[model samples]
Structures are given as structure tokens and as C-alpha cells.
Target: MIQLKTREEIELMYESAQLVSKTLGILAKEVRPGVTTLYLDKIAEEYIRDHGAVPGFLGLYDFPNTLCMSPNEQVVHGIPNHKPLKDGDIISIDCGALKNGFYGDQAFTFAVGTIDPEIDKMMRITRQSLYAGIKKCKVGNRIGDISFAIQLICENAGYGVVRELVGHGLGKEMHEDPQVPNYGRKGSGPKIEEGLVIAIEPMVNLGTYKVKFHNDGWTVTTRDNQPSCHFEHDVAVVNGEPKLLSTYKYINEALGITSNEEDEFLYNFMHD
Candidate 1:
């Protein structure tokens, strides 16, 4: 069943979501060449705890990490390891936090240092597709509206939209109802309604959409060994519109980037 969150509940989830955003921001400053993802994982776990929220992903599924660190071809669920990140590599860090009986989840793919121009463009397109999907998350629209929007943006740019992994509704539990896929028909799936909270993530690959599971039973990679990008946001439908409960401002701040990509999705109740 799809769990609709109350305004108060959504506010609480926003707090949890902000912590995840802050956690990502902290890691952003350290995501340079020679830094190990395991090291970043340790920093995230400690920071989340220090802020009074538990690590949402750690131990949730017998998984043993605070963040899903997938670099280069790995799409998602990559476990943190001792291998150091190299220049030109990109890593997707998906994080979640549980606080006040609610959950907040978000992800971002970051460039380790100077990266290939083609890979950089893929990341830009994938991130833009995330907002395209968010724009459709208003009242009177079906889940497919959001899915199709994302699919269109990526496919038009000749990118592969990952079909195996999809975004999900989020609330008290980490994952909820209304599976949000990146590819779907224009007028299909569940009808979006007020109070619906979801994590809309677009995992776009530079090659074919096909992916393969690693032997570790955790990491997922593009079938053709091409680079992939992942971007996510937590959103809630309110008063016939979609409001962003999470922000990439923290991450952008760390990277010295200033963009108003999220201005349209800001909720009135949320303070700056």
C-alpha cells in the first residue's frame, strides 16, 4: 500500500533528508583522487550518528555500509572498499537517514577530479532528467508521467536508462509503495496524489541499459562496462504541487556550484 505522509510527518522526513544532504556535502570535500570510499563511509556513519540520526542503509538488508559507493560503471549498491578513487572516476553515493520515525533518502554521482568530457556530459544529462521527473510529480498525474519524463530526457541524449533498479516511495520505512521506474508509458501506473512522498532517481548509463550483478551479490554494473550516472531527490506532493524535501545545495556548496535548479520545487513551509 502507498503510505501518504501527513504534513507534520513530511516535515520530520525533511529533517532526516537534510542530514543526508549534509552528510553528502561533508564527503564532497573529501572525494578527491587517493581517497578511499571506505574512508568516506566511515565519515558518513560518524557524522549521521553525531547528528542523532541512525544510518538508514547500514544493516537494513544485512548490508554493511553507511553509503552505496558505486564508481565508474557500477550503477548502484556498490560496497565501500579499500581501493582508492582515481582521477577521472565518478562515484555515486546513495545515502539515507532515519530520524523521528521517518526516512530520507538521496543520491548523487560525483567526479573524483578532472573527468572525461563525455562522462561529464552524461552526468549533467542524468541529473537534469531527475528534475524532469520531479516536475511531473504533482496532483492528477500518474506515476508513469514522472517515469516517462525521465526516460525521454535520457533517451533523447542517447543515454541508457537503467530498468532493473527503480526509485521508490519513502516514509517511516525506507522503501514504500508506488515503484518509480525511469522508463514507462506516458499514461500508466498509479495516480499520484497529495501527501505522496517518493524518491525519484534516474540511473542513466552511457551504454546499453542492460546491467549485471557482481559476485559479491551487492554491486551492480553496466553490462557493456560503460560509465553510468545516478541522481536522486526526495519529494512530496502538496497542495496540487510537488515540494522538494531534500536539497543538493549542500553538495553544490561543497563543489562551489550555484544553480537554481531546485527553485521551482521549493515548498513554502520549508525555511531557507
Candidate 2:
């Protein structure tokens, strides 16, 4: 069944989103060459707990990390380890936080240093696909429309769209109702409604559309062993439009980059 949020519950969700935002902000500053993802995961756990929220991913279903740090060909759910990220490598960091009985989840694929043009293009376009998907999250639209928007953009670029994993609704629990897939036909699936919040993420690869899971049972990688990109945002439908609850501003600010990509979604929030 689909779960809807009340106005007051939405506020609580917003608070949870903010904690996730802050956690990503800190991770942004600490992501650099030679830094181990395991180290970053520890930092995230402490940061979330210090702020009164728990790390939503840790020990949830026996998973062992505060963050899902997938690097290079890894699609998602890659476990953090002592491996040091080298120059030209890209890693995807997906995080979740629980605050005030609500959950916030977000993900970002980042370059360790200067990367190849091909991988860079994959990252840029995959990130753009995330926005395309978000644009479809509005009142009266179906979840399939949002998925189609993402698939249309990413596939047109010759990138492989992962089919196994998916995004999902967010509320008191880390995973809620309505699985949000990255590939679907328009006009299919659940209808969008006000107070409906979801995490729209697109995991695109430079190779085939297939992926394989490691024997460790958590990490997932592209089947062809080529590079992949993943980007995400938590969005809420309000006033007949999609309102973004997660922002990459923290990442951009820390990296000294500037992009007005999210201005459309946060126009009123910026002014207020």
C-alpha cells in the first residue's frame, strides 16, 4: 500500500532530510584521493549520532556500514572498506539518516581527482538524468512517467540503465511504499499525489545494462566491469510540483563548483 504523509509528518520528514543534507555536507569535504571509504563511513556515523539522528543504514537488515560506497563499476550497495581511493577513480556514496521518526536518503557519484573524459561525461549526464526524473514527480503523474523520463535521457546517451535495484518512498522507515524504478513506460505504475515523497535515483553504466553481485552478497557491479554513475534526490510533491528535499549544493560548494541545476526545484526555499 502507498503511504501518504500529513502536513505535520511532512515537516518531520523535512527535518530528517536536513540531517541527511548535513551528513552529506561533511562527507563532501572529506572525500579526496587516498581517503578510504571505510574511514568516511565512520565519520558519517559519528556526525549523524552527534546531531541526534541515527545512521539509518548501519545494522539495518544486518548491513554493516553507515554509507553505501560504490566505486567505479560498482552500481550500488558497495560496502566501504580500507581501500584508498586513487586518482581518476569515482565512487558513489549513498547515505540514509533517521531523525524525529523520519528517514532521509540520498546518493552522489564523485570523482576522486581528475578523471577520464568518458567517465566524466557519464557522471555529468547521469546527474542530469536525475533531474529529468525529478521533473516528473508531481501531482497527477504516474511513477512510470518519472522512470521513463530518466530512462529516456540516459539511454539516449548510450549509457546502460541498471534494472535490478530501484529507488523507493521515504518516511518513518528507511524504505516505504512504491518502488521507484529507473526504467519504465510512461503512464504506468502508481499515481503521484501531494505529500508523496520519494528518492529518485538513476544508476547508469558505460557498458551493458546488466550488473552482478559480489560473493560478499552486498556489492553490485556492472556485468561488463565498466564504469558506472549514480545520482539521487529526495523529492516531495507539493502545490502540484516536485519540491526537492535533498540538494547537491553541499557537494558543489565543497568542490568549488557552481551549477544552477536545482534552482528550479528550490526556488521558493532559496528565497525563504
**Model 1 off-target regions past 4 Å?**
270-272
For each candidate, what is the lDDT?
0.94, 0.89
Estimate the lDDT of model 1. Answer: 0.94
lDDT of 2 by residue, 162-206 (tens): 999999999988888899999999999999998898999899999
Q: Candidate 2, 170: how far from true, in Å?
A: 0.8
User: Which candidate number would show the highest lDDT if scored against the true structure?
Assistant: 1
Candidate 2 weakest ten by summed lDDT: 263-272
In model 2, the Cα lDDT at residue 265 comes to 87
Candidate 1 C-alpha RMSD relative to the actual structure: 1.2
